[model samples]
Target: MPQEFSRTERVADYLQQELAKLLLHSVRDPRAEFVNITAVDVSRDLRYAKVYYTKLGVESAEAATDVTRVLDKAAGFLRTEVAKGSSLRTVPKLTFKFDESVGRGRHMEDLLGRARASDALRGNEAEADDS
Candidate 1:
């Protein structure tokens, strides 16, 4: 019978959980304090993993950069911790990436709101002309 999830998917899920715990309690960098792991993608061979993360309290570009820098620097230590916590033969190399989807979504929402407001104003103007 075919399995629902492949080994790499299972490993990625496990790593995501472990990494969240490590980032929350073990990592002490102030820049990374607000960091939240959003998702993890592991390679099919299990040799590499890309970790997507976002900040909680701050939304500035500089703050995002700082968080990414801190996480990237601590990747080695985090990988070691993962190895110690898991039974995998080889822990995947960690790569930290700032997740921009949240920001993009917010921007899109703002644009949509502006468009709606403009449409409503135009509709009111058309009614005034019709009267």
Candidate 2:
């Protein structure tokens, strides 16, 4: 029988959970205080992992860049911390990326709200025309 989850997927899940905890309670940088680990993608060879994160209440480009910089600067420390909790032979290189999907989702919601309002107005106009 085929395995339920591939090794890479399992590793990604482990990294995601552990990283979330470490970022929340271990990392002391103020800039990383509100960082949320959105997802973790591990390569097939497990040589590198892309860590996606987004800062709570921070959507500006500069703020995103700042968080990314801080995380990247602390990558080595984070890797070591992860190593302490894992049985993997080698910890994958960490790369921090600011996840923009949250911001994009917000923007999409705003657009959808406007569209709904526009449709409502048109509906009212049509009702008035029928009267």
Candidate 3:
């Protein structure tokens, strides 16, 4: 059988976990606060990594930009920190991206809820007509 996960995928998983910890306790920038790493995509050659994150506790467009800037500026430092924990020959260049899926998911849920309410209201009206 082939390997369950390719080298790039394994690296991505490792980066996601280590980056989360580093951002949680190692990074001291206030702008970097509340960063949650949703996923990491490592290039097939392992030369680059794109980290997807979401801001917690008062997320805003401006705040998201600030967090992205801070993370990008600190990419070298984060990479070094990550290197200390892994045996890879070279650490991938880090790139931070604000994960929009979470926000989209919330929006989808809101739309679904409204649809359910509308269906319920229609059901009540039908019952009244039947009485």
* TM-scores for all predictions: 0.87, 0.95, 0.94
Candidate 1 stretches with Cα past 4 Å from truth are 57-63
How would you encode candidate 3's per-residue C-alpha lDDT over 1-131 as one tens digit per residue? Answer: 99999999999999999999999999999888888999999998999999999988634555588789999999999999999989999999999988888887888899999999999999999999999
Off by over 4 Å in 3: 57-63
Local distance difference test, each candidate: 0.88, 0.91, 0.91
Write the residue-wise lDDT of candidate 2 on 1-131 in tens digits: 99999999999999999999998888999988988888999999999999998888987666689788899999999999999989999899999898888998999999999999999999999999999
Q: Which stretches of candidate 2 lie over 4 Å from their true place?
A: 60-62
Error of 1 at 128 (Å): 2.2
Clashes of each: 0, 0, 0
Q: Lowest lDDT 10-mer window, candidate 2?
A: 58-67
lDDT of 1 by residue, 1-131 (tens): 99999998898889889999999999998778867788899998889999988888655555678778888899999999999987899999999888888888888999999999999999999999999
Highest-TM-score candidate: 2
